[model samples]
Target chain A: MSSISLEVKDLAINLSGNQVIKDMNFKIKKNTLTTFLGPSGSGKTTVLRAIAGLNQKIAGKILLDDTEIQNLAANQRNIGMIFQSYALFPNLSVFENVAYGLRVRKEPKATIKEKVDAILKTVNLQDKEQSYPENLSGGQKQRVAIARAMVLEPKILLLDEPLSALDAKIRIELRNQIREYQQRLGITMLFVTHDQAEAMAISDEIIVMDNGKVQQQGSPLEIYTHPQNIFIAKFIGNHNILDAAQLRSLGVELAENDKSNFIIRPELFQISITGDSSDYMAVSGKVKNISILGDRFEYRFITENGLELKVEFLNQQQAFMIETAITFYVKKDNIERVGI
Target chain B: MEKHIDRIIAKIVITLISIYLAAPIVATIMYSFAKSWVNTILPDGWTFEWYLQLITNSDFLSALARSIILGFVTTIIAMCCFLPVVFYANVYDESIKAKLRFITVLPFTIPGIVLVTGLVRVYANLPVPQMLVLLLAISLLSLPVTYQALDNAFIAHDFRAMFEQALILGDSPIKAFVKVVIPNIRVGMFIAMLLTFTNAFGEYVLTNIILGGNYETLKIYMYRLMQSNGQASSVLTTVYFFFLAIISIIMIAIMKWQGSKKAEEVEDTKKL
Candidate 1:
């Protein structure tokens, strides 16, 4: 068996007359969760739908287990999808909705019941077996949708913003539950979402996309700490992008042959009241604004040259009044150089 | 104070509208039961003899049966033709819906007289059965109601997602539609079928113009009675009005049941 459960090569899709997904290529490993993270019109869902054989691909190949299956109808593809809307059949009870696939395949009555009951238990929804979808809460309905898709035992499961419709607390709980179930069942999952934090929370690998293209794909830590371009730097976290002139004004000199933008994370700057550090590049600034972010303090520092930069520090119950003069330092090795 | 006045005004308006709408039916009912009502504020006597006579008439029973058969056949044909088309338009190709908007205005643009004239010109001499042509024409005429009701059914759910999910679960398109899509929209479909059946049941112009007296439907029987006997005609009209009232009651009851079921679901969700 191939290590890759699903692969898309040079996939392109057009809706009406405009191209929605362009030359998209990605591979999902077996029993691992990968996320397609991007903004709304970034073609993330388009690529995911193409992989499930739901959307027609104008040009490309979709391989499942190293065998081409792009031409197969969506039903024949043996893939499952959970939509953001939960898409539960309002007429069917929870058990019926979960058993829909098994019933379609003509599974025996006893087996369908056994499988549905087991899967419903896995999602902690055994008590909701007789409840219709409309009577359930959003979180409960989503759980039913998950159970319905998972009961089919698909080769790969595609989740399109499954938690986007959920509340904050429920979203966190459901995402953790989904990741747990994916691991327990050993099913390959392709999750699509515009929320970066959700993708970072549960994905084994995150493919960041924008404007119908894959901007970057990597482990969450790698993508977060070492963004390859300015877009990724700006999108992934609160990173300050400074040009050569801005860096010079901040008392940090670029390399002799280098004039690219530097991506500096907020927490990378070490702040102090006294200018005692000469080994690292340093600048003096005042705390223009301070936002108490529960666990950390985000300080907007303005340097002598009037260059504004964001600096963050772990909250230690210390007091720093507004307009307090402070010095911040960063080593040359800590900055990431990104192209224009 | 303002709210009380508003309530009073609303009640008066509703009462006036009710009287205006119900006056004709009330007069017809009174006429059906009157023994000698001419030039009198009230009937000199009331009797059930007209109703008994109409009920005993063999032609009246056959006319009622024919109208029912027409209703059932037209409803079946309308569902067969428009259900799949409306589902396709709503789920897959929304552009088809834009093309189908013309069906809604077809009756206004081409009156039944004009359509029957065209149908007679084309199929009057053809080997095709006139009854079949009439049935087909009636079904076509009822398409607007069928299409609109069926289309409304799809608005409440993400039917595409539900259908695609079912397909991914191993159902062919037809099987998925029958198993998953149909149940979700059954209420709406039922309401549509009822409306179509009601429309076809009460049809007069196309039936009279196309099939004529050969297919003596209830409406045709009523029209004939109107010229010959006033008491008998009033009785037939009253019977027709009751039939319509029963159908209207059924439709309203179904709508109310559906609404309550939805309200219960909402209440359940809120409790959750």
Candidate 2:
């Protein structure tokens, strides 16, 4: 197994007498991109800030390469951070902004120029070295911010929703660029975002948090395929979840009620003619609505017990009419059993 | 049609009010330049004699120099003393900020005469120079204005961006303040300097009471000249007014430049 690049153990953060992060623990391996994924106000950003040493009142131990650094100031931590706002120096030219770290370390002017030039080229900002931050586009500003952080070559790079402020197209473009840059540099990175798709797109591993606690932590496929609890199942992707009692009444034997949850991804449900199929769990429902989503048709249905379920088909040609009574089959293996 | 009529009436009213506000300064300048005109709506003749006389007066020259020096000194001292504390309060502890804000404004809200009177009584026993006492008084009075200007600047800044970038770049707080915060809020700093300079230049009561006629600022020169009541006094007033007008023009030019720069930035961002 790869050695841990960064580790947080029983970390807690309180702000103005309110607990924001509670006993959060995670370990990120070297040369990997780890993401903290959660909704707004879920303390994901707070946890990232704690790791960066931006949150002073944080409790518990944070180890960077096996060295305890929880008490270090943000500058002393040597952790590069890209804020949601990009945080580029408005007055400085792109070159100066990127060269700021080297200058602060008292590097010789020649070396500063060489490193800054190289890093600017790395972020595709070499042509715009003379541009002030205020004159740059959102995407360009984000790149500058990235370059500014990367030039320091710190232990870990912390990105606090860096692409959240960009337009959808720009966000996608920047996200891919960031992932490519991270891969090229082979640096450990902790990316924080509320968007699951963005997190899943780049993360080697993702920690889904909710209400100040870690709900689940795993690789993208692991999280999508097998969430550890209901929150994770709901948070990672769209899911049609039902209580064990409800699943049991549908001829699905749930192993336990108090500790397990029945979760089926929206796309996992199969629409077909009713038949005796040992390898699949079947349910009968009336289609309530149909949405054409280009490549797929999303069907919303109401089960006999009033549970709402969403099922998707490959095309509108496969969609059943509204109010049509049908049985949806979920392959048994695809029906994930999550323990809370 | 009715709305248009109302708009015309409103414009006229605004124009008249603007004229009323500006008339006194215009009249002052006219009287100062008039060769011998008196009790007339317009000057009988225009001459540069008053302006010339002001150039030759040694006492007037000394007072003008003192005013400029005091203005520069007071603004420098006020900014150095207040900005760090204000920036700290703004960033770290907001609760303490409220109390500090109150303290900074205490000198402004209290009646100037009363405050100067108290200062005189208290400082009479101290073995400080009269000029030092005068500088202290002017700085104290100007602190509230300077602090407010800087505080507003801090509010207008993207502080999260400032700190985050600084951290990522491994910059200490002081370096960040010098490089990032100061440049971003240059307009605000300029306005603060102008305000402090104007306050110290025009301040009369504090200087009068503090120096007790030993030291003279531009305002004191004008006051002394006003006692004689003639072209000399008018010339002194004109000199003071001209200096203030020059400062005001410079401030406006700086403000306009900043605005245009901001607009250019916006346009550039849009293009991207």
Candidate 3:
């Protein structure tokens, strides 16, 4: 199958009188799942609506497979979107909902039947082909919704918080199915989610946003290990954000004007018994709290200089549980500096 | 003991309210079938002679026919025009909704006498038929109920999302509305139509004031019979009561049909 790429350039959206989405640009690579990761009201869903041409007052060029489609009507764009509500026509049975687009396009009856049947099977909703949306469980309704969209064979599928409404078990289970389907079909998908774990699990690349603008866009690991700003660091993990002055007092290498903060992961801090103190900056602290997290142990500690710290250790050692006066070591190489 | 008393008091209040509301209609129904009901609290005699006398009158038949025709046509006009208008106002032009709310309440605030007087003074010189004017007037009076029904139709479900989803699935706005929106809001539209029909059917003041002798509706026909043929008029009233009862049954049937159709299952094989 041929590949399709979607690129948005300098997109700005103004709703009523206020600007909701500022100048935004992003490219969804071919056959890759890229998620717009942000909290609610961060303009992520606004971007999805704009791309679908539902928000007409957008100023930008949206190019799909090298053709500008900003002027196209929503129906004319041929982009399939899975709404958060699933939005399955309540009056329509599962079969009719899947056959709706095909019927609108005036496809042959037998072909519509075959395609709808196959798609329903693909989503594991064949048993529910006769049921209405209200009669089905939340997971079944979502699968029918997916089957309805997938049967259309659109160029790109836009999922706007598709799994956010489901329970934890169904969400993870269905999202993994969607990811597998994305891989099998090699379909270009731009999934919008507020969950960092969801983005990390499903996306080939994740675009993190706070306000309207993109905070950081990269692989989940690249984003997690090397957050460009304090927002991304604070958002992605439970890392301790220490300012330049605090780090300087701890005697890490830095210039005089290094006023920016630094991120230290919990797992990166080590006990001085295993590592040489000459190579790593060593500090002793009072253990404030300790909690076991299955495979890892988390400790809240306050140093002599009054800097609070959270450090996680592998469950292989219970010795740290009793050590309140133990020294912790942090390598200069492991300290990640924030650019902003 | 106190809680039991509270429950008993609540039940008594509810039963009293129900009887109070039902008493007038019960009295009216009893009066319509009576031979001489004024001498005592109980009706003097129950007879079908008034009904037989009512059906034999050509004027009564024509008035009944006229009222039904007008009510049906007015309901069709209201639904055909107002449903789309409400849908558009809700989905596209929200500003028009404020105007619709004002117009819906206009019929209720202005007395029917005042409205008829204004309309007569305005349309007195026009060459149009008085029947059409009355039909249009009755329909206008039913607008508030129709608009509210349509509003509820859109609001009670995920209508906006369904429309947008259909649009994304390659349906034009019109096609999406007719095929997707119309079917889903079918129950609401039916209710609005029924309300409009009942309003037009039972309307008296406006019909009498504006188009009384020229295009006599059932209400005007009954009013005339009250003086000339009181028993026949009572018979007409009984028939009208039955007509309304039949309509109510039909509305309930429509509601039941919608409910049953929604819960039905299609037997598709090739289960996964």
| Candidate that scores best on DockQ | 1
Error (Å) of candidate 1 at residue A223 is: 0.5
Judged by DockQ relative to the true structure, which candidate is superior, 1 or 2? Answer: 1
Global lDDT scores for all candidate models: 0.87, 0.84, 0.85
Clash counts for all predictions: 0, 0, 0
Query: RMSD (Cα, Å) of candidate 1?
Result: 2.9
Q: Give the range of the ten consecutive residues with the poorest summed lDDT in model 1 chain A.
A: A271-280
Candidate 2 DockQ, CA atoms = 0.69
lDDT of 1 by residue, B117-216 (tens): 9999999779999999999999888888888888898898989888888878888889889988899899889989999988998999999988788999
- Write one digit per residue (lDDT tens) for candidate 1, span A172-232: 9989988988889898999998888998999999999998888888999999999888888
Model 2 clash pairs are none
Q: How would you encode candidate 2's per-residue C-alpha lDDT over B1-272 as one tens digit per residue?
A: 99999999999999999999888777777788888876777788999988888889898899989888989998888788877777777777667877977888888689989988888888889997877777888888888888888788777556756765786577777787887777877888888989998999898998888885777888888888888856778778767777788989998898788789769877877787
Candidate 2 lDDT, A208-231, residue by residue in tens = 999999888889999998889888
**Of the pair 1 and 3, which is ahead by DockQ?**
1
- Who wins the TM-score comparison? 1
After superposition on all C-alphas, the RMSD of every candidate to the true structure, in Å, is: 2.9, 3.2, 4.1
